[model samples]
Target chain A: MKKIDICLTPELLHLYELTDRIVVVVDILRATSCMTTALAHGVEKIIPVATLEECRALQAQGYISAAERDAKKADGFELDNSPFSYMQEHLKGKTIAMTTTNGTLAITRSREAIQVIIGSFLNKTAVVEYLRSQPHDVLILCAGWKGRVNLEDTLFAGAVVDELKDEFLIEDDATLGAHTIYGCAKYNMLKSMASSSHVKRLHRLNLARDIEFCIREDEYQVIPILQGNALVAMVKA
Target chain B: MKKIDICLTPELLHLYELTDRIVVVVDILRATSCMTTALAHGVEKIIPVATLEECRALQAQGYISAAERDAKKADGFELDNSPFSYMQEHLKGKTIAMTTTNGTLAITRSREAIQVIIGSFLNKTAVVEYLRSQPHDVLILCAGWKGRVNLEDTLFAGAVVDELKDEFLIEDDATLGAHTIYGCAKYNMLKSMASSSHVKRLHRLNLARDIEFCIREDEYQVIPILQGNALVAMVKA
Candidate 1:
């Protein structure tokens, strides 16, 4: 039986002796959600870089930059982390060079796994469906905020664990913790997390709708897998 | 108003430019609990070292050794991480040279903070009561298993947050996540954490009693504060 584990925050990556596991990187508060939404909306490829400099440098290579710093659009970047921005008509078939505070950092750090992919509430079913097909043990990697654990990411990680709770042999305290958190937040996520620091911060700044849209279950059905540093839609034949 | 934040694992220390805040280091499985118990039971002082070598070296200087590695007492050490083990008749008025897998590591890493203290379910109220009196911001640093997040430590961190939720300005997602986990586990800590890996591991080894005893809320009322290189009971005036 394959075991399912989780690294609730990317900061814990150094503690894991990761190898041959299917890693699903989740950043529910906008980054991975945006990436999932981008693939679902027909973006050609997403080159996820870790630094703002890398996101800027890629523009020279004909990749349109979509960068974020601390939940806002990077000062000079052409795109913010909003899912709605990924739905633009002109971005179809174009490659996006993207960087964010949390999501991209997790993607770069997860290169050691057998496979790395993007996941969020927006594409929850697609991710769960795809993982249920893979034979290897699963590792849900939460791209927390700037090297710290965040609620939205933890909630998404937990949600996936709940979805696959019966299909896999859950391993470690984190897997169980994520499962417990998801159960508490699934029915009324916004209400459950009304007091969470990130949710409260974003709500105060009037970004409540982003949190609202990000938690919508199964809104899109797409799994973005990393193929040599670019996230492309994993199309099943 | 002081802002209360959390670094759930040692890996997040870099993200926090910590200053002027009191850091409560928690290793709820057994270590911090043991330290708190040792102090509550009138142990003179505990010199917490991060390695087996440091603990062993102190034995030659007349300090009794207490060391654990991979959840068991280290070879030739005088004691393991069980809190019950600390309630010994001979342990009173004695200074223990202690080292554990997670607790000592977190204490060592928390040197940059204004102060570091030990916290566990055993000394829950003592820690909270003391924090309520202090004017400084509080940071509950969970000493997770080997730099990774663990169930018991995160739960203890959450308990502290819940106790202080109304009094402090909680600053991050990890803080909120901890509080939520605490809420789910408060009424039935053992049952809520039955599926967590550490609990199962200890149960298989017939140490279920230790788990039950460790989660007993406010079982002891001693606050162990780091004084110089040793953790001594903070004498209240």
Candidate 2:
């Protein structure tokens, strides 16, 4: 059986051999959630940049800029890290250049993988289905806050593992731990995450609704996958 | 109130500030458990080295050499990674030089902290008591198997968080997640860790009794604290 593993944070990515694996990059509070939401709602594609300057540079090419740092929108960006902003009708068919403190960095760092895909609660079912159809091992990479492990991303990872456990070999402790955390939090994720650092960080910025929206299951059916330099919605086969 | 955090693996240690923190280094499957047992049973001191060569060199200075790699004792070493060996009556007053894949590396890497201490299920109560008396932030550093996270050490870290939650500000997701994992696994840790990677590795080597002995709570009342270059049991007032 193929293996399903989890890298709790990007800093520990070096320990894994990503060569033949399908990497599911998750940043549940936002980032990947926004990308999943954006694509599902009609945004053409997303260009995930590592820095705000790179995101800003793409604006000159007519791409919409979405940037966040420390839980707030970066100055001069056209959009912030929220799924609601990406769902606006005006953004249909628009290309977005995005950079965030954690999520974008995780996506860029995972370029070495055979396949890099965005994962979030909004697109969990789609991600599971996509992985179920593939023949390679899966690595759930949680984009934790600034190199630190966070609960929300891990919960999303666990949710996927719970769905795929019967079909995949759950061998690593990180995956087991994430699966257990999901078992505990799936009943009332928002309440379970009331004490989480990232939840509190976003709540202080009045993004509680975004947090709620991010954790809602199966809100979208699209998977944002890396294609060369940009992320495009993978066409369902 | 002081803050309590857990660094799940040593590779993530760079993300944390260790200069003024009290680092609790734990390798529950063997290394730290052996250190605590040795010090509690009248062993003079343990010199934890990162490499087997360092441990072998200390053997020339009349110190007993204990080295483990990939869960087996090194060929030329006098002692293996079992707590029972340290419990023997013949080892009294002997100084041990130890090296292991995970535990010793964690101890040496944590030298930057104001205080470096060894913790395991063998001395969980003593570790909590020492932390309660200290005025600095606590960072439970799990010596994961070769920089990858493991269930036993994370559960041990969670056990400590459960005891000290009310006394400390459990701010990070790692501590909160660990506390939750402890809540789920405390009732039956061995079974919870049956599927753990390291447990299966040691069990294949017929070290099941060592695993059972390592998780026994409060078996030792001693807290092993690092002083200069050796670990010696702290005197309780």
Candidate 3:
């Protein structure tokens, strides 16, 4: 039987050998959600860079860039960490060089995996369909706040595990924890996540709309797949 | 306002500088629960050693000892990681040297905290009552399985947060995640933990009854305090 494991945070990457596993990287609060939204709206590709310098260097090469940190847009970046920011009409067919505090770091750290697929509540079904088609083991890796585990990403991981747990063995306590949390919050995602640290933080910064947008299920049907340092929408056959 | 936080793993001890926080260490699937059961049964003090050598050294110096690893009793040890084993008739007024995989490591790593109190479902009410009287910030630290985060500890941490969340400002996503899980599992503790990795592991070893005893709420009013090198049941005045 295929196994389903959850690495709750990128810091736990050392715990698993990711030789042939399909890694689904989730940052549901905004990063992956934004990437999914961008791809759904016809954005060509997203180059997720780990550092601000790399994003800036890519921007100098004429690619549009966005930067975010501590729930705010970094200086000198045209866009911040909002799903709506990535939905601009001009962004259609334009490649984006993006850097965020959590998502970009997770994607960069997980570069060694066989396949790294972007996961978000916005694109859950598409990602799930892709996972069902794969013969390899699936690992839902949450891109937590900085290196510590966060609530929103974990809830997303749990949601995926809940849908596909019967098909594979639930590997660890962390995975079970995620599945349990998903059971609790699956009924009302918005209300359940209202008190989450990231949601609460963004609310304090008057970004409540972003939280609502990020957690909206099936908002995007495209599964963003990493190919040669860029994430582009790919339809699973 | 006072703040409430939860560190789900001992590996996160470095992320927190516990200068003014009342640190409550919870190892709910057995260690802290065992300590609580022992104290409630009138055991004098527990010398929690992180390493087998330290436990052995303490044992050699005229103290009863118990050693546990990977959900099983270690070789040459008279006792295992069950709460019922500590509820012995002969254990009254006796000191013990103990070493376990997760709990002892958390207790050792949290040596820098201002106050370290052992927490379990058995002593939930007493721990909460004590926290209510404390002016310092509170950090519920879960001693997870090995260095990885676990479901039961996080659920226990959440249960504590659920009670005290209104009184204090929750600090981070980890805390929120814990609180959410607690909200999910509060009504049916056993059912919620039925699928956890550790519980299933112990169940396979025929330790199903231990799981029942460990999750019993407020079974004991004794809160074990880490005083110098020993854990002694301390009643809050």
Candidate 4:
């Protein structure tokens, strides 16, 4: 069986030894969440840019622009980091060039992996199904906040491990650690992470609703795969 | 009250707005453990260089050398990563220049903090005493394996939090998360983490004894402090 592992943060990436694995990038609050929701709600595709300048350049070339830094919408962008922002009718059928604080950087960094897929709680089942079909080893890349392991991403990894443990060999301690954290917190995630610095920061910003919404499992079925510089919904071959 | 936090891994480090806090670095899987033991055994001082070349250059100046990478002794070095290596009579009263895979890199990255202290389970009480005397905020830096969060360092952080919780405010979710992890595994740490990738790798190399020795509480009472590019034990003025 192919080994399944979890990298709790982008900084733990060197341990990835990423020569042959298919890396599933996750940013549960709220980059991948936003991407999944965007595609599910009829957005055409997301071009994940590493910087605001790149996002603006894509806009200059006629794509709809969205940029977030520190979890808030940048001054010139049309949408914020909130998944709710992507649910609007105006976003439907439009291509978005997006930049985020942590998630985009992770996607860019894992470009060298055999394949990079965006994983979120919104599309958990579909992601698991796709991984089960692939022949390669799987690595869940949690795009932790600024290179630090945060609860939401690890919880998502845990949920994935919980779903796939029967089909794959989970070899890394981080994988077991994530599953343990998920098992303990899955019942009432908000209460479990009420004291999380990221959640508190969101609460401070009056975006607690975003945190609640992001944790809802399997809300969407869109499995996003990196194609060139953009993430397009995976189409079964 | 000063905010105190522990980053369970170097990947989690950037989450720290490390602008003005005192960073206490802990790498129980030997670097910080070795430093604590070296000081406790009456070694005069420790110079932590980031590279083996620097250690070699320091050794050329007549300093005794101790260098390690991936938990093994460097070629031609007098000491390996094991704390037991520092316990020998030859190290008594001698200045040693040292470099290791993770801990030294963490200390180097944390040079910008208000203060940086090397911490391990061995020197837990002395570290708490020092923190009690200082007025600055504190951040426990876990020099996790090659920048990933490992079990032993997080456990050590939990031990410190358990000790100093009355005086310092635990302000971040990572600290709470680490404390919870420690609480869950306190009674059976060796068994709980026997499956860890780092531990397994160590076991493959016959270094399980080093892991056991590294996690023992209060094995030493010496706290290593960074002073002008080298880590030396603090002397009371």
Q: Compared with the real two-chain complex, what DockQ does model 2 have?
A: 0.90
Off by over 4 Å in 2: none
Between prediction 2 and prediction 4, which has the larger lDDT?
A: 2
The sequence of per-residue lDDT tens digits that candidate 2 reaches over residues B50-92 is 9988988998887889999998889999999988889888789
**Best candidate (score: DockQ):** 2
Q: How many residue pairs clash in each candidate?
A: 0, 0, 0, 2
Candidate 1: which stretches are off by over 4 Å?
Answer: none
Preferred candidate (lDDT higher): 1 or 4 = 1
TM-score for each model: 0.95, 0.98, 0.93, 0.89
Candidate that scores best on lDDT: 2
Clashing residue pairs for model 4: A147-B11, A148-B12
Chain A TM-score across all models, in listed order: 0.96, 0.98, 0.98, 0.96
Candidate order by TM-score, decreasing, is: 2, 1, 3, 4
List the candidate 3 regions with Cα displacement exceeding 4 Å. Answer: none
True contacts kept of each: 0.88, 0.87, 0.75, 0.46
* Clashing residue pairs, backbone N/CA/C < 3 A, model 3: none
lDDT of 4 by residue, A1-237 (tens): 888999887887876778788999999888999999998898888999899999988989999888889978899887889999889998888889999999999999998898999999889999999999989999999888876678888888989999999989977667877887777788888898886767877888899889889888899888888999888888888
DockQ of each: 0.74, 0.90, 0.62, 0.44
Instruction: Using DockQ, rank the candidates from best to worst.
Output: 2, 1, 3, 4
lDDT string, candidate 3, A1-237, tens digits:
889998888888877878898889999878999999999999999999999999999989999989999989999988898999988899999999999999989888888889999999898888888888889998888998877888889889988988898788876888887787888878888888887778888998999888888888898889999999999998665
The superposed Cα distance between candidate 3 and the true structure at residue B214, in angstroms, equals: 1.6
Query: How far in Å is the alpha carbon of A215 misplaced in model 3?
Result: 2.5
The alpha-carbon interface RMSD of model 2 comes to 0.6
How well is each residue in B162-182 modelled by candidate 4, as lDDT tens digits? 778888887666677677777
